[model samples]
Target: MATIRALVPTQLERRMKTPAFGRRALLAGFGIGALGALTGCRAEGFAPSAVPNGNIGSNLNIYTWGDYSDPANLEEFGRQGVQVQTDSFASNEELIAKLGATRGTSGYDIVVPTSTYLTLMSKNGLLEKLDLGKIPNLANLDPEFQDSIADPQNAYAVCKNWGTTGFLYDSTVINRPMNSWADFLEAAQNEASNNVSLLEDPAEIAVIYLAAKGYDPLSTDPKIVAECADYLTNQLAPHVRAFSSTPQNFIIQGSMTLVHAFNGDARRGYLEAENPERWKWVFPTPTANRWMDTWAIPVGVQHPDAAYAFINFMLQPDQALKDVDYIGYSTGLTGQRELAEAAGLKMLDVLFPPAEILDRLVSLEITEASGAWVDMYGAMQAKAGA
Candidate 1:
């Protein structure tokens, strides 16, 4: 996921900085200015428009990850007289902090958070209970995602899109068959030394060490967590060029040869690269994180009807296809793979992995020990002078 440097203003700046990079940007050949115009909002000095009186208001405010939504969809929705405004968060922590500090008066009607954060957000009364009745398209969701472990009853969130956490390497540079996290580590230390980039996420960084060592990546045991931290600080950190969530740019620039990345971004980087055949994506064995991002309404949502309408509209097969095609992630909707193939999306294997690869993927759960992993990551980064 792309990290937003600041809450709103920085998001606009980042979009402007990389206007012609993402698939949507390339396909439409428009910059952030054009996108803002199409969505009925100005990229500079953007603020939520007045919500006209109605069940579905005239404006919808969305808070989500950067480059996750397609401008075309929002523009199409705008044709119905509902102006759309989107702001981005760098991480779940940033999302939680902004919402918590505002005490639910952030003016955001909808938020897309990773599924693991659903229970925490609901417990804190940060989220509003979703009325599935408003979303008849819920039936269109894949049965597997319908029973989310974090929100099993679908009381608070609906799966938006899902992808795996893995690494990718430039085959032309490495000259080795890289498959597992172990190989990733070795390559990082040798062939890719001083040029490797890992995701800027703590929990994701933990997965690299823990999964490679044959331990549960989500393991909260203090000893295991400490061990992973030690390995990162002592072994992996020296070789890492940068810690970043948006490594696609580095991949495209040919600045980083191997990167720890979410499959979606890796696929995007691969396809966008000048020599795409040099990139090799891996579904690391024997385990990796299979994360799902979800759509939920915040507690003080001002445009509830518009929130429901937008969610339901996105759940439709056609919109979902556009979403997956643009973002390069699975929407957890049935037959999405077939739809994507029919639409001529490249890198189907990376976007929708095989069943065997899926079986090795694991879901991350928020637990009391979650904070320990974050602390370990910080300590590792500090000790390594990263």
Candidate 2:
């Protein structure tokens, strides 16, 4: 099993800026690098170990999104004889790109990635197969999440939280309503003008462009991909204020009245407002994409059983409900949605999203053939920054 270590925030901040050795330095500081040296674990050499006497947290480690797993939960798990330590990553690509370069040296027991990259990671043998027997509580997960194609048959990943990508803004300034991706594109170009922005995620930007042209966001056809990139370059290039990875920051400052964002973030930000009544979420008659966050055991995890236990612990219906409510995203837990709705969440189709929009919503897929899309977006982002 991997030994635990404390995370140093200052060191992590500097490492994050270097672009080289950033991930290795962070993993090394977190004790994962030490485990790598002790075990000589290679990318293909890892296998699951026993549950470690249910003292799960004593040596358990998780690399996940910011603030998703609270200390109270860790304390509770510790009471059950499990001790958990956590680390955070700001984006899916950051985690993926880092882990890819690390060549499986990380001692992490779990990773939370959005669906597409989870699929990509699993397909590339970067994650471990889930052992269902270790996760009885996962029975409480939504049926829709089971057998999900992102990593079918419980092979790689488990859905953690889910939300749709859309726009949110002050209702007063917009006057009417923004109800489509096209509306946002035009608003950025003519109405909201420089006040609007989009998410900086390459996949997200691709989907946004695909949706604007009424094409499947996840289409594999080269012609469709090229068309989407060209349309985005032509329509959204000039008017965007910035391709901000964190739209909430700009929204709160009022410098950005409209920006493409995830649903839960929009809600949480509005709820935090001095005047919550002034803000609103625009699902746009056609939302661009519905996304899911997932938890998966990366290949070479030494403490496999503990990883499963952690996954099961989070999947408990009550736990799932609390987490989704706290994080402001919909849970894949079967009964949690109703609980959240009863608790006064507006619970719009926007959360589940409507079938028509869901059909249009594309799942981003990774492929060797995707270089064109990646290169195009990279160029667009550079130009946008310039």
Mark the regions of model 1 whose C-alpha exceeds 4 Å error after superposition: 1-55, 383-386
lDDT of 1 by residue, 70-164 (tens): 77788877666688887766556556767777787989899988887887788777899988878878888988888777897799999899988
Displacement of the residue 103 alpha carbon in candidate 2, Å: 4.2
Q: Per-candidate TM vs. native?
A: 0.85, 0.79
lDDT of 2 by residue, 61-151 (tens): 7887666654555555545544566776665555765566666777778888877676567656677778777777767887877777677
- Give the Cα-based TM-score of candidate 2 against the true structure: 0.79
Off-target runs (Cα >4 Å) in candidate 2 are 1-57, 101-104, 220-223, 285-287, 342-360, 367-369, 382-386
Model 2 is weakest, by summed lDDT over 10 consecutive residues, at 33-42
Error of 1 at 170 (Å): 2.0
Q: C-alpha displacement of 113 in model 1, angstroms?
A: 1.1
Model 2 scores a C-alpha lDDT of 0.63
